[model samples]
Target: MCYVMSYIRMAMCVILFLTLFTGMCVADSKGNLALNGMAVQSSLGHPQGDAQNAVDGNRDSDYKKESCTFTKTEFNPWWRVDLGNVYTVSNVTITNRGDCCKERLRGAQIRIGNKLDNNGNNNELAATILTAPNGTQTFSFESVNGRYVNIFLPGNDEILTLCEVEVFAEKKLLINI
Candidate 1:
């Protein structure tokens, strides 16, 4: 037979490309990183690709010099997102940024990780994906988990923008390399 049917069709195309590209490579934290934990400091914020430089909110006006440029105002460029580690965040997605969607963006807030856990208490600002009528605001934080994810960009003088920010992890995915 044609060389055993071309080696069984190249081993069934390498087992269907290893179960459809490794079928969501499973292990744990999507890409593994439990070497003892504690050691994640991702600059943890906006200012990328230029969403009006991400934020310089509440500038001057007697606030005693804090935010310099990029403080147009409709709400205040809010993107304080800082979910460095301590996973368990269901979902989060924000898009269309840089030149900002012509300002006037009102309502967008999130605050996680009040700390305290370990039998202390506190830690409970769960879910508030801006209720509704806030279209354009992408969010799917299923169970309302937390870990420091603040993104309050509401009508900050009409200056809002985002370009793909998806952070989701409920389970599945270890190393799909």
Candidate 2:
């Protein structure tokens, strides 16, 4: 009789512990609720899920496994996501991509908020267009502010190669809003 009673008490303790743990888990998932106010965008191969993925695409960790190369060209071209908001970039991660893929890199550009193309104005190029290094580079941007971002790819006569180019930034809250 004592053994059975002890087992029942143990079972009760487990059930209580599980219930409390579940509550804590819920709070952890919804640790902080953010009110939508600023732009949050990215093209790090996938949707914006974390700060580390600021710039998007495959990186050294996984690129070798998949024979697929990240590519940019004049035809399909590279892209810059508007993130639906503006942010102050803190870091940038560029993953080595492409064996040059089916397409090639002409050149690539990235820019923060500026009225270049949107104004129907031409001749003015992107404010922050970048040249992919011969090798691979992980770069960062700090102390700059802008809203719209631009990415330009002026295809090299040969093809350019890349896996992913990611930008990391801290979301800025607009007081005017």
Candidate 3:
């Protein structure tokens, strides 16, 4: 009877560990709420490089081919997205143009908040990319609540080209204790 009780206790410990571990894993997966098909805008009005191309679910990375959006070289060139409703954002993924001139994305600041004032530049600073990447990059920051996600490139002679922009957020879950 003692051996039987010991076996039961061991089994219970294993079950408890698995339960806790599984819950933790699930928590991370629940934070990536897809923000596809959302509205996108840019400071420059390129006929072929419209802001909407960034969120069209394509990461073509070829700006010359009109696969991404491009802003006219200017001071503080910016791009923004509207999530329609406010959300608890977990991260922002940006696909940079890989064909050429990837360095144009350097020193880009990502801002997130509900405010639309000042072209969304007044929003909260989420993260910044020190080195411009040639491919897809994910910028993860502490979860923030916002409806507008804007990317600003500070300085003159800079153009903003984006192949794609993906916003992930935490989904609200209701739990009854």
Residues 7-112, candidate 2, lDDT per residue (tens digit)? Answer: 9999988867765664321111111111122222222332222222223343542344451233322343344444333345544444444343322332454545
Instruction: Flag clash pairs in model 3.
Output: none
Point out the worst 10-residue segment of candidate 1 by lDDT.
33-42
Residue 25 of candidate 3: its Cα lDDT? 18
Report the candidate with higher TM-score, 1 versus 3.
Answer: 3
lDDT of every model, 2 decimals: 0.40, 0.39, 0.78
Model 3 segments beyond 4 Å from truth? 1-42, 173-177
| TM-score for predicted model 3 compared with the true structure | 0.74
Judging by TM-score, tell me the better candidate of 1 and 2: 2
Q: Higher lDDT: candidate 1 or 2?
A: 1
Residue 22's C-alpha lDDT in candidate 2?
43
Say which prediction, candidate 1 or candidate 3, comes out ahead on lDDT: 3
Estimate TM-scores for all models.
Answer: 0.27, 0.42, 0.74
**CA shift at 154, candidate 3, in angstroms?**
1.1
Residue-pair clashes, model 3: 0
User: Roughly what TM-score does model 2 have, to 2 decimal places?
Assistant: 0.42
Q: Write the per-residue lDDT of candidate 1 for residues 1-177, one digit (tens) a residue.
A: 999999999999986787687642334555322212221111223333232222322212211132212223443344433344555666554432323242333354544453533211234444444433222344564544444444445442444333333455667433323
